[model samples]
Target: MGIFDKIKEKLSHEFIDIIEWLDYTDDTICHRFERYQNEIKNNAKLIVREGQTAVFINEGQLADVFKPGTYTLSTQNLPILTTLKGWKYGFDSPFKAEVYFVNTHLFTDEKWGTKNPITLNDERFGLVEIRAFGSYAFKINDAGKFIVDIVGTDNNFTNFEINEHLKSLIATRFTDTVGEAKLPIELYAANTTELSETCKEVMQPEFNSVGISLEKFFIENVSMPEDLKKEIFEYSRLDKIDLDKLTKFKTAKAIEAAATNEGGTAGAGMGMGMGFVLAQQMGGMMAPQMGGQQQAPMQQVNTMPPPMPQAIQYFYSANGQQAGPVAFEQLKALFANRTVNKDSLIWKQGMTNWSPLLEVEELKAFLGGNTPPPLPGS
Candidate 1:
């Protein structure tokens, strides 16, 4: 072969004729077509497979974008690139331009989580901190815009790079949406589906700004502090508790304790008091049940002679001296004569200390009926 023939063969070999990409790594979002200083020959065949898009950048400006299809690089098909290159007429020589293949398939299982707890104001819980995490899916929508805005000069861009940015964006938008939602803290877990949809809607515009499409968003779990969780759980049981029954249960327990400690004087006294109170309660409870039996009134009447009455004596403080123990009738006469008044200290058998006459239940009867004036000083 002649020298000219050899040079033509070398020049032909130096130009790229077929421009395509076979993506092996599923994580790759964009891969630059490696030409190694070789220019693309005129009428070069551009192969854009399914789930992929071809973007051409000329002179640092996004020029032509091709969807999944076979394309021949020409003035007709490369209108934007041709115009940017000022090629009024299509050229026959090789052209130098950047070709990038962007993955248009959904990139799923991208994780997003709040690194710090999101503070939210809840009506029942007040200010609460919660953390959330879940997976999301996305895809490149506008290849040209994506190349221009995010993947600039990135020869091989993987989802890892973009995921970090997307996760931060998702976290921010998630916090904002959750806070604005104002849902009860306890409902966050139960309503994750609704919250996820709302978060997707809120973050779609952010993704769109950079030519990405948020295909799916999810909130797998929302969690609060363990203590807060326990508190919420306990609060939920409040309506289930029967306070009256609980009080009775506590009283029964106290009585049991008093009965077990018969050795101590204090315990004995407590046992006696508890027994009296318990008897009164039992009597009150039985009254209704007995009355409901429809028994005739005569059946409840006593058939035996009544027991003799025991008189209760009283004592009074007269002129700073302890007076004799007077009968109840005599005590009433003393009160009527103004020898003792409601304020006069009095005591009775089994009484712990002297009490004001007005404070005594049995003596209160003396103050009723006709009013009597105080006697003149003798």
Candidate 2:
């Protein structure tokens, strides 16, 4: 070959060598090449199977190399590196990568926690406590909106953030749906399971935008107002008042029975007094018949004459001397008929013994001016 041709061939070979060197040094010298490689690796996406996960590795970064299974991406594995120096010398891994969705069911069961199921009775005022853990199955159905408006492409999303958003979404949708349902407050207070189901049904469409399938949901617990609970308790025990009134009525009836028994005893005493008066009247009628009968067989009979009428002796107030005669028969008759109350004495100690002072006739005669002298101080 001629010297000019040799020189041209040599220039061509040198140019090819420079191109190969540029390709080799692209990771360090070309920002576009580095970004392109990063995009390719990061976008190495996979559809997360029901029981599996997917992991994405950066081309050259210090990172933990994962097994071939899918894994949920977390903050623990971030900032995928795309340079040889970062892979070899940096504390971080060259294979900076993202772990895709992991099947949480592998590590947890229904007991771990579950989504609350919706029912047909949830209301606006109702509250429910829901329990769930780990990342849930979701997809960015509206990729463009999710990347641009909902969550920026540069932003790293987390399960906690997703859960919070989900909670807010659920609450808002539940409130709207409950308002539309126009359910009674009583239903909201009483039916928690129904409320949860209704909430799920109402929230399904809203969650669809975020690609959450709402696998299952339940109302772990419900909290109600204390005053409402107290009202319910009072209503349930309403019979207590009636029972108290009945007890009082029974006690009153028992007291009335006791009073009736005492009154009956008093009536019996009155009846006995009436019987005695009746007997006295009947005896007076029989006395005349006995007086008319006489024995005709009398031979030598010794008969006693009627007793002489006794005189009542009185004493003078000045000397306490026996002073005058009073008819004892009249006084005795006055006492027996109760026309004179002999027991009504005004005598004091050191005075004379009890003695009759006035008969009923004496009282009448004194009033008619058949006077006796006023004695002593009188």
Candidate 3:
């Protein structure tokens, strides 16, 4: 080939070849050339340092020369500059991107500073304090598209703008999830953990749209109205009150039963005493009629004028002195006339011996008017 043609071919082959020759030196030149070629082939990578902000380009403008290392704007030719000034940096690998977070909002409160804003409070229905809010982190998966479709040649995009948009999106999704829950105020107030978990559950799908994965969401505190709190306390104590009332009822019933039994015993004793007194009076009144019948019989049956005109009788028997037949009428008369105290009669077992009973008054009251007559000659 002609020198001119060869020179032209070398220069015109591929931009990569020209760059390779330009960087070549010695044995290391080949290694350097290979490394550069590989870097170009895979598209140049950059590094976003820790605690630094970065701009992404979608125009593939950085596909050739970008290197994977922390960089700052030391030279004017630096391809991009972030709006955050020194805050901007880049990462070559998704792993390196993880070292720095993009600080995008996974969710935002449209009701930002309103009375009832979209916060832990909104989900839990109480005064909740948010310590650390939810945010997202992402890396440019497609460097070419990141450069071309996103920030283009200029690195002038504001993280605030991206964060705000993301915040709005998160807020919108969060609102929808919360609205659909329809949780009761009381239950929501009590279960802050559950509320946070529920928010995370609902936000997962929406967060995916912005190339972020939600790490976690948590509720710190919950507050409710004073009246509501008091009501809850009262309700919890209700069972104890009911138990106390039941105990009192049982005690009252036992007392009432004891009183009733005691009264009945007293009344029964009084009635017995009154019955005895009435029996004694009736017996005394009938005594005289019985005496009259006995006297008449004696008047009829006594052959000899009443032996001694007596309330007495003589005894004559073949073996010994025996009481002559006491006129039945006289005996009957004695008993009926109350001449004899019926209550005083007592009989012995073997001999029909008669004796006076002790406690005669008690006996007479217990026996009615028809009590048997005392034995003769006693």
> Which candidate's lDDT is highest?
1
Question: Per the 3 Å backbone cut-off, how many clashing residue pairs does candidate 2 have?
Answer: 26
Candidate 2 lDDT tens digits, 1-378: 999999997545432111001122211111111222221232232233333222332332223333334433323333343343243333421223322222222111122123453333334335433222222233334332332334333323444445557655655565555456666544545565676677677666676664445655554544445675565465556667564333333333333443455467654543443344334434545779877988578687759788644333222221233321212332222333343453332232244564344433333342334666699997
On residues 69-185, what C-alpha lDDT tens digit does candidate 1 reach at each position?
998888999999888988987788889999999999999998999999999888887888999999999999999899999999989999999999999999999999998888888
In model 1, what lDDT does residue 365 have? 82
Each candidate's number of clashing pairs is 0, 26, 28
The predicted structure with the larger lDDT, 1 or 3, is 1
TM-score of each: 0.66, 0.31, 0.30
- lDDT of candidates 1 onward, in order: 0.85, 0.39, 0.39
Look at candidate 3 and tell me the lDDT of residue 156.
Answer: 33
Model 3 shows how many backbone clashes?
Answer: 28
Q: Cα lDDT of model 2 overall?
A: 0.39
Full candidate order by TM-score, most accurate first: 1, 2, 3
Ranking by lDDT: 1, 2, 3
Worst 10 residues of 1 by lDDT: 243-252
Off by over 4 Å in 1: 1-9, 245-378
